[model samples]
Target: MIKVSEALAIVAENSSNMPVQRIPVRKALGYILAETLYSPIDMPPFRQSAMDGYAFIHSEKHQYDVISTSQAGDHSNIKLNENEAVRIFTGAFVPKNADTVVMQEHVLANKDSILIAAMPPQFSNIRNKGEQIAKEEVVFEANTLITPAAIGFLACLGITEITVYKKPKVAILVTGNELVKPGKKLPKGKIYESNSVMLEAALQTIGINKTKVYKVKDNLKATKKALKGILEKYDVVLISGGISVGDYDFVKDALLANGVEELFYKINQKPGKPMFFGSKKDTLVFALPGNPASSLTNFYIYVYPAIKNRMGFSDIHLPKLVRKLNDPITNTTGKTLFLKALYDETNVTILDGQASSMLNTFAIANSLLIVPDDVEGLKKGQLVTLLPIN
Candidate 1:
């Protein structure tokens, strides 16, 4: 087995670089931008009024003639003369020679003229052209994630669509005749199958929605046919179970039989020791151990990064930090142990149920306390690497 870091590096080098395509700005949320976004025109495209009252040149003012009124979306370009004001509402274009706007509540209104009871600072209520963004200004850098505010800002710049990297189309295969679907009666020694559902939800959290799931018996022939079909259609294939060297384990053999070359077999890590990675042409594949916690851990560490790389994201790993251990733990084996942990403002507590098949404490976990393989024993208050999960 190789170190976890080495396995990550190999997967990084082998990840597929998906092509970028133009999509509607509304559909680009959470997607990495493939190109820089520039403002098409100056924000607002005109000098605009920032308040509702009157628009006029600032000076030692008392009363002035009220010209025509202008509200938001008005196309009229009514000009203002000296000592004259125009009734203007918020977002209305500031007519020529108008330099300021006073709030309606602070002004005394009459039929012909209005008194400026409270004078605003010169040019105080005027939103000048290009105040928010200039024409052709670089609004967003390449690889910037599109947010809700970005959508609003892009709409202001008259942008209807943007270019972004495409999300991966994934196919999942859960192999094992001993596995039974949820809601069905547990007959004999069979357990409820949950890997596909968990993985599908995991993929959804990363913004992948185009996914198909299939189930196959442990037989080698059936597994091979299923792998071949999924490999032909999907960009990524995730197989749960049949990776370990057991008599019924046929994932490795099935992959090789279908021309899927193995890149790695296992990592020097606990819970997910028998993880397998492979790729054939444009389709990347992962065969995770059947244990619930083990498969989930492998997905977060290896599969998540590979998919993120294809989506053109810069950071492809879980958020990590160093925290003081709240309790003592021991690692008798050479494998690096990843313990489910709960953390507060500063400290992290390693919870119970670190077993590969047990997931009772996983629901309460917010991070994984990584105990290195070389470190056999750790005491409380020691600073250890922690990987945050939401």
Candidate 2:
């Protein structure tokens, strides 16, 4: 019965990074960079205009005449001298001997000559070459998650492709002879299978869109056969609803018989104490509790971090927010409890009917209120830790 933090450390230390794969920039969002990206060329590689103005030498005061017009992508072999200025539009390259730009509104322009109405500051409105970024600089570091902003930055550096970590394949399995699929009428004493679909959607939110789902009956032979066959095909296997102390609870025994080394079982947490974890041939397996709230909590507290670590993310925890409790709540004194909560600007209110079997509580919860194991109860207006759900 190790603490949750201790168990997390163990799992993180054991997980390995995924293999690197080359992907186009458009498809690299949410993937982790496997290699450092260096800039091949300078940003704004040449001197250009920062505004629509006249480019001229600052040393030549208000007495200057418009010599030639320069627009973007204009590589005209034009030169400037004293008392001469170029009609420069935005992003046009500054001609030689022009070190300053005067806005059109600040100057009086006639047919041939232009008069500076005000004194233009030195280097004003002139965008220098390589001012934004220098060549050969490290733009994106290795192991960084590729976000939309990161992808845009890479594209700005002319990077069309990048090396990123491959996504892990997760296999979701649901067990119960009385369980039936959704959209079909269930017989008496039967319920629609939901753990598999919920877990599949949850995994997709964490950037793992590829998953294999299997629904097995509550039988040792069928469960064992499914586990043995799928263990080799996926990096992580998630089995729901067969780890409790029932006559048909055979997940733990089957894994042991098949040579899977148990890492830990029966955590001291509420709603998910019967959860189990094990490994065999580099494939990780998690036996989640059957209840909807327990399964969701187990995924957030354990499985999510495991998958994130393998994807090259260094920080695998959700962001925490500080909030005041809106109502008092009581819990057992020896096991940590994660209560489904809804938090806004003023207060965080625990959802009613927090039992493991309640699914509606989870649907409205935007955060989880983390109650310590030794605490018995909380009072209204007391500050508590809130973990936001993505």
TM-score of every prediction relative to native: 0.96, 0.91
- Which 10-residue window of candidate 1 scores lowest in summed lDDT? 74-83
Off by over 4 Å in 2: 59-63, 103-120
Top-TM-score candidate index: 1
Report the Cα lDDT for candidate 1. 0.89
lDDT per residue as tens, model 1, 79-152: 77778999999999889788888999999999989998888888888899999989989999987778888887
lDDT of 2 by residue, 1-390 (tens): 767766777777666788889999999988989998889988878888998989998884787988899999887777888889999999998996788998888988898888889867889998887887889988878889898998888898889999998888899989888898899988999988899888989998889987989888888998888888888788889999999999999888888877788888888777677888888877888999998889989998889989998898878877789899999978765888888899998799998878998889798799889888888999999999988885
Superposition error at 247 for model 1 (Å):
0.7
**Candidate 2, which ten residues in sequence have the lowest lDDT sum?**
1-10
Backbone atom clashes (below 3 Å) for every candidate: 0, 0
Candidate models: Cα lDDT each: 0.89, 0.87
